[model samples]
Target: MAMMPRMELRQGQSLVMTPQLLQAIKLLQLSHLELQNFVEGELERNPLLERDDAADVPPHANGGDGPLAADADSFARAESLNSQDGMETRLGTALDNVFQGEQPTVARLDTHGADSLPVIGGAYGGSGGSFEEGPEGFESSLTAEASLHDHLGAQLDLAITDLAERIIGQHLIDAVDDSGYLGEPVGEIAERLGITSARVERVLAVIQGFDPSGVAARDVCECLSIQLRDRNRFDPAMQALVSNLHLVAKRDFAALKRICGVDDEDIADMVAEIRRLDPKPGRAFGGSTAETVVPDVFIRAAPDGSWLVDLNPDTLPRVLINQTYHARVSRAARNDVEKAFIAECLQTANWLTRSLEQRARTILKVASEIVRQQDGFFAHGVEHLRPLNLKTVADAIGMHESTVSRVTSNKYLTCSRGVFEMKYFFSAAIAATGYGEAHSAEAVRFRIKQMIDDEKPAEVLSDDAIVSKLKDGGIDIARRTVAKYRESLRIPSSMERRREKVAMAAGGR
Candidate 1:
C-alpha cells in the first residue's frame, strides 16, 4: 500500500473525562462533612486559600458557625448528629468526642446489635445526659432509639447456656435487620460468623424461644414455628401450618385444610391462630429513639413568598491557608525549587477555592431542582414525593446523570418536614391505572408500611388485599410484587405478622 500525505479535517463526537473534571465530579458526591475535611486538607497543603476567623465569612466558609465546642456538644448537638469545625454528620455525629482526648476512640461506632459494648457516643451523656437536647441552634426531630438486634442480643445474653451459645446467638442477632427479622439465610450467616450451620440452627432455635419469642429464624415461617413451640400449644394443624409456610403464604386454603384435616370453619380458626404469633421478636427493642437523616441544604420559605436555599450553616467548616506562613513563604522565597513549589501550591490553592465555589453551585442547582420536582413533598408530606430520577434532575439543571448521581449520593437536604438523603426524593414511577394518577415507588413503600401498621389484628391485609387497597388509591401492583416490597421494608409475611400478634397477645396476657 502506498502512503499518501494528505491534510484533511473530520469531525466526530466523543466524551473524555479530564483529570480536573473527574476530581470535581468526585468532590460532588461527598457529604458536607467530607467536603469540608477535604478543603481543610487542601488548605494545609496550599498556601493561597485562607479561612477567616474574624472577618466577614464567605457564604460557605469552613468553621463559619464556630462548630459545636467539645464541652458544648452536650448542650448543642444531638447524639445522632455531630458538628466538627462547622461540618455536621448525621450518622457519624459524635466523632469529635470519640477521639477528643489523649485516648483515641474510633469516631464511628458499630451500630450492630452487639451490646455489652456501649453504642457509639453512649458514654458522652447520650442516653441520660444534657446531650439529649441535640445540637444548639439546629432542630432535629429524630431521637435516638434502641435497635431490634440489641434487644434480641440482650435477651440472648441472659438466656443462652454458655459463652459459645451466646456467641452463636449474637451472630444470629447480628444477621437480623432493623425490624428484627433474619433477612440472611442461616447457612450464610454461619459461614460469615465462622460457625457451623448446625450451631447456628441450634442457637437460633434457642434464641427464637428467648423473650419476645419470634427471633433468630431464617424465614417468617420458622420464626412463627419457634414462637409457637415457646407457647407450648403446638398442634397438628399448627405444625402443618409452619411446615407448609409457603402454602399458607399463598392462601392455598383448600390444600392447607386438607393437609390439616379441617373444614372451612376450622381453616379460619387455624389461620387465625397461626396469625397470632410473633415474627420479629426483636421489634420490641428498647434503647435510643428517633433515628433520621440530616440534610446538607436547607430551603427556607421567606415571608415574601420566595425561597432562600442555603447550605446547612452547621456544615460550613473553618479551614484555610495559614495566613502567617503563606505571607512569610511569599516574601522569603529565593531558590528555584522553593519558587516552583510555591507556584504548585498556588495553583493547588486556586483550584481548591474554585472547586469549593463549584461545589456550592452544583449542590444548590441540584437541590433547587429537587425542590422544584418535589414541591408537593415539601408542601404536603412524603406521600407527595413525586416520581423522580437522576436524569430528571440532570436534564432540568443541564447536567449529566452521573453528575446528578454523584451530587445526590452522600448529600442530604433538610426541609421543614425532616432531613433526608438527596436521593430519597427520587423514586421509581408506578404507572397509574384507571383509578388515579401514577405514584412514586417510595410513596407506595411508605403507604405499604402505613397499611401494615393500621391493619386490625383480626384482619391483616394480604398482598392481594393490599393491591386492592392500592388500586382504590389508583396504583396497580401485584400480590407477589407487594410481597417483595413488604420484604424490602423488612416487614413480615401475613403468617409471620399473625404470629407476632399472637405472641404480643400472650405477653400482654
Candidate 2:
C-alpha cells in the first residue's frame, strides 16, 4: 500500500531524564569519598548551599541560627514527600516540575583485598624506619625516597671519573629494576650502546657494590652471591647453595643439604641466614602507603534484638540550604536573568539537599534488608550468609532491581562481623541434596577457606578431599567448585600449600 504524508496527532507519556533526576540517580551510586567530593563541588557553585554545622554545636547552645536552618526544613519536606503513597514517583515528579524551565548552565567542575605476601621489613633506615623526635615534634618521612636509579646514579657520579664509563654506568643502572636485578643482559645492553660487553660487565660489577649490595645483578643467584660476598660469607658451600636457589624455594631441604655439602644443623643455619637477605633490595627505596577504605553504613544490634542501620556520621556530608540568602537574592533580583539565576540556584540547592537525605535513607533501607535477609550472618558468621540476589531485596523493599543494585555498588556496611561491601551479602545459590536449604556461594567459600586454614600441613586437603568434606556438611558442590572457591579466597593450591608448609617446618628445625 502507498502511504501519503498527512498531519496527525497522538497522545503519549514517557519518562524524561531531567538534570535533577539524573543527579539523584548518580548520587545513589557514588561511594562515600566520591559523594563527599560531589557535594563539596555543589557547595562551591551554589551560593544557596552550605554545610549544616549545627550537629557539631554543643547541646546547651545547639540551636541553629540564620539560613542554615533551611536544611532541616528541606529534610522535613523530604520526609513529607517520602510519606506519600508513591514516594519515589512523586519525588521524581516534583523534581521534574522544579527544573522544567531551567536552562542548563555550564558549570566548570574540575574533575582490593589482595592476599599479599607479608611485606618483609626493610633494611635499617629504609621504608620501615621509625620516626624520631626532631628539634620540632616527631618528624615524618613524607618525602619520596630516592629511587633505585637515583641512588645508583649518585654512586656512579661519585665513583666513576671517566665520562664515557659514567655514561655506560648510567645506562647499566637504567637496566636495573626496582627489585635490584638487571632486566637486560650486559651483552644486549653493550650491543645497544655500541660498547664492549666486558666494559659493561666491569661497570655493572662496580654498580652492584653500591649501598643496596645487589642492585645490578642479572639473576637471583648472582644477587644473593653479591650480598654474601660483601659480608665475607660467600664460601664454596654457600656458592653451591646460591647456585641451586630453586631447590631452596621448593623447600627440598634434603636436596639443598646435599648440594651445599653441609649437615642438617649447618644447612638449617644457612637457610635461616638466607631468609634474612633482601630478595627485592630496591623495593625498600620508594613505595606508597596503601589507601584505606571507610565504610558508608554502620549496622549495630538494637536493644530490641534487631539490626539497627545508620549512616556513618563521619562519612555522611552535612549540607544545609541558605534560605535567608536565597530569599534575599530573590527579593533583590532586578531582571529576568538575575531572577532565573536565583531560582535555578534555589532549586538546585534544595534538590541536592533532599537528594543527599534520600541517598542516606536508600543506603539504610538496602542495608536493613540485607541485615534482615542475612540476619544469621550478623548473629553467627559468614557460614550463615543466605543466598541473596538484587531482585529479592528489590521485591522486599518495593524498589526496582537497578535501584537496589546501585545502592549496593561501591557501598560498604560495617557490623559485628567487620566491614564488608554491600555486594558481599548477595551470593549465588549453591545447591544442596535432600530436604535442606541451598547455601550461599560466599558462605561455601568461607567454609572452604576455614577447612584449608585448619588443615594440617602433613594432611593438606586436595580439591577432591575438600569436595568430600563439603558434601558431608550438606553442600552439594563439585571438586572444581571447591577449587574455584579456594582460588577466589587467595588460598594456594594443595601442592603449593604443601611446599609452604615444608618450608615452615624446615625453618623451625
Candidate 3:
C-alpha cells in the first residue's frame, strides 16, 4: 500500500507567487530612495507610468485640441494637487472612487511641518510630517561640481585631438577611485584595454593637469608630485620626500633629513609643507557624489526644544498608472489575446500601487520604532544613542530580524547633527548597571566625546585613562575596547594627540 502510485483526482489549492507577485514582494522591501529610483526606471520603461512632474512643466506646453494639460497641472499642483501629469492628460486613476475622488494636489513637502503629510517608509518614525525648507535668510545649494570624470570630459573636449584619445581618457579617469588613486598600473590597464602604456600615460598626464591637479596618478606620492611639479615647486628636496613616502609615514624624520640632505629643522618644515598638499587633489573639485544618499528620515528642532521626526518627502516616490493610456490600450486591442495582455498589464499596475502603499506602511512602522527607541537622541544628542539591536527594533516593530536588517541597511536618518546611516544608530550592547539592561554604545560614544571635550588639552587622555573614567561613571569597558571605539570615532592615539596639541600651542605662541 505504501508503494502504490497515487491516482487521487481530488482538487487542492495553494498560494503560488506569480512573476508579478514576486516583483511586488521585492518592491515592498526597498527603502524610500530605492523605491524612488525603481519607480523612475519603470516610468522610463513603461509608457503607462510616470512621476508627478507637474511641478516642473508649464501649462499649454502639451497644445491644441489636446492642449498640453501640463500647464494646468502645474497650476493645480501649485494649488496643492501634487500630480504626475496634467489634469486633462489624466493618468489612469483607478476611478469611480477615493484616490480619484480626492485627487491629490501637488503638495510640496512642508519645510515647516504642515497639517497633513504624505506617508513615507518605516525608515522614518511617527505620524509627523517633514518640514525641510531652508529658514528665512537661508539659501540651500550644494557647492560640489559634477565630478572628476565630468571635469575630465569637459577638458578632453577642449584638449584632445582624436576621439579615441578622449574615449581612452574617460576610462582612465573612471579608473581613478574616490581616493584619487589609479590603483591599476598603467601597463595593466593598457593590456586590459588593448592600448599602449605610452598612450595611457599621455592621456593620464592630460587628466592630471585638470583642475584638481594630480588626479590620475597611480600612487599617493606620484599624485602629490603631479601637483607639486605642476606648481613648479617640486624641487630636488621635495621630490626625494615624495618618492620616499614609506619612510615619511614610518615617522623616520632622520631618514627624511638624510635623504633631502637637510637638517632636522628643514625636514620638519618641509614635512609640514608637504602635509598642506592635497593627497586626493581630484576630490578638491566635486566628483559625481553619486555615492551621496538622501536620508530617509529627518528630525528637526522645534522652538519648544522638542525634536520632530519625519520622512523625507523626496524619498517617497509619487507614481500613477496611466489610466487613460490603459483605456486606450484596451480600446485599441485587436483580439482576445491582446485584451488579455492589456488586462495583465492592468493587474501589474494595480499590484505596483498596492506594493507602494505597503512599502510606505513598513517604512513608517520602522521609523516610528527608531524614534521611540532613540527619543533620548532627539532630545539630548548622540550621547543618548541607546545600544539597540535588530531584535529590539524587530520586537518593537512586530517584524522579523531579517526585515529590520533590510530596513536599516543603506537607509539614512537626518538630524540636527547630520545625516547618518540608520545602521549607525544601532550599536552593540555595552555593560552598564552592574548586570542589568546594557547601555547603548551610542550613549557610550557620546560619553566618550563629552569626556574628551571636558579634558584639559595640556594632557591628552590615553585609552586606558578613558576606560578608567568610564568605569567611574558606571560603565564597565576594557581599555583596549575603548581604544577600538576611539579609533572608530577617528580619534588619534595619545602620541598623535600630543603632536597636534604641541602644533596648536606653537602656532598660538
Candidate 4:
C-alpha cells in the first residue's frame, strides 16, 4: 500500500426527498380536516396563493392564455377524459409515474356535475339533497348541554349550606370521576383536607343523596345500594344480591338463589331490578360531543350494473395560485430578496395546488380499485367480502404498499351498504378446503355470526361445530381461529351461550 494522494472520478445515483416531495407525501396521507388546515395555513403565509372560490370558468373563457388558464384547461381535459373512460382504462399506469420525476398532471374537479361530484342518492339511498350541507342546520343552532361537573356543582351549591360541610362536599365532588364514582377514599380525603374521617363520611352521605340517584358512591356495589335504597327496595335479599355481583356475572342462578335466600322467581326479579340501576351515573352528563365522520369518497351503483366511484368535492380543498397578483408583485419587486420571496411563494403555491389535485385523484383511483375488487360485498353483503390486502391494492394500482396504506388511513368510503373506513375492506384470507377461492376472514366471521344467530337453543353450535360447518362451506379454519373471531364479535363460550339461552327460555315461560 502506498501513502499517496490521488484524484479519481466516480459516478453514482441516490434517491433524494426534496421538501416539495415530502410535502406532497404528507398531503397525500392527511385526512380531509388536516389537509384543509394545512392549506389554510399556506394561504395565510403565501400572498400569491388564494382560495378557488370563483365560479367555474371555461378553459376557453380567457383564450387559455396565462399559466393559470392553461392549467385549468389541462385539468378540464383530464377530467373529461377520465369521465368518458372506465376506471380500468384510466388507471393504466401508477400515479407515481405521472407525478414523480415527471411533469405533474392536474386533474379537473367538477363542483356542479352529479356525474363527477358526490351526491346524496344512489349508494347512500338518501333523499334528494346536498350531501355537503353537513351538520349545520339544526345541530349548529342548538346550545351546549351542561357537563357532569357543572350539574353536580349546581346541585352541591343548593344542597349544602354550612360553610364547613359545603367545603367538604366540594372536595368530594372534585374527587368524583366522570363515571360518578368517588376516586379518593374517605381516609385519604380526610388526611388531605386535615379533617376527621367521620366528617368526610358525613359529607359523602349528604352528597350521595343528591339528584341523579348515585352521584357519589365509592364502588359499583355502593352505587347500586344507593339507588336501591332511594327506590326503597334495598331489602336483605337485594343487599345479598348486590354484594355478590360475581355470581350474577357468571349467570349462576343456583348460587345466587342460595346466597340471596330467594326462590327462582324472586331472585330473577331482584336481578332484573339490579340491571335497571345506572352503573355509570355521570356518563349521561359532561361528556365530549360526538363527531360525525365525513366520508372521503362516494360509491354508487351505475345503470350499467357497475360501481360508479366519485370523490367527495366537499372534502377536497379548493385552492389556486393567483398568477395575476404574482405577476404584479414580481414587476414591483424592489430588491432581489423581495423577488426571491415572491418566486418562492409562487413555487410553493403551485406545488400545493398540484399536490391537492393529485391527492384527490390518487384517493379516487385507489377507492375505485377497492370498489371493483370488493364488488361482491357491495352487491351482496359482508358475507361476500373477498380477502384483500394493501399489497394487492398497491400492485393493482401500480403504487407502493406504503402509499396505499397512507391513502386508506383516516379515510372512509360511503356506499349502499353503509359508510365504512377504507381499511375495513382489507382482511386476512382463510384458506379454502379444496380448489376454491379463499374466504375473507371478515366474510367467515359474518358466516359464523349468522350461524350462531340462527342456531336453536337446543342446537347451540360450539366452536368445533362452527369449524365443521365452515369446513363444509369450503372455509378451512381452525377451532382457535373461530374462537378468536367469536370473542372479537363479543360472543361468549358455548357453555355461557347455552346457559343464557336456557335462562331466556325459562324467563319467557
Q: How many residue pairs clash in each candidate?
A: 28, 0, 27, 2
* lDDT rank order: 4, 2, 3, 1
lDDT of each: 0.65, 0.74, 0.66, 0.77
Worst 10 residues of 3 by lDDT: 89-98
What digit string (tens of lDDT, one per residue) describes model 3 on residues 1-509? 37866677888876665666566556645765566667666666666665555342112222225212223234334334223322221112221122222212112222233333343244322233444565632335534457666666688779875545555666676677766778678887666556578987888888888767777788788888988888788999999998898776656676788889999788878888788888876666565436567777666655654445565656666667888899888899999999887776676666666556555555555665676677777667777677888899887656777767876767787777788887887889889857666778777877887777776658788888998888888889888788878887887777666666666676689
Which has the better lDDT: candidate 2, or candidate 4? Answer: 4
Model 2 bad stretches (over 4 Å): 3-8, 54-91, 94-249, 252-273, 280-291, 499-509
What TM-score would you give candidate 2 relative to the actual structure?
Answer: 0.66
Residue 399 displacement in candidate 2 (angstroms): 1.7
Model 2: lDDT of residue 174: 70
lDDT of 1 by residue, 401-458 (tens): 8878987888887767877888888899897787567799999999999999998768
- Tens-digit lDDT track of model 2 for 276-314: 898788897863345578787767775545555656665
Model 4: residues >4 Å from true position, as ranges? 1-10, 54-142, 159-209, 216-222, 232-240, 283-286
**In terms of lDDT, which candidate is strongest?**
4
Q: Could you tell me the TM-score of candidate 3? A: 0.69
Q: What is the lDDT of candidate 2?
A: 0.74
lDDT over C-alpha atoms for residue 53 of model 1 = 40
Error of 1 at 352 (Å): 3.7
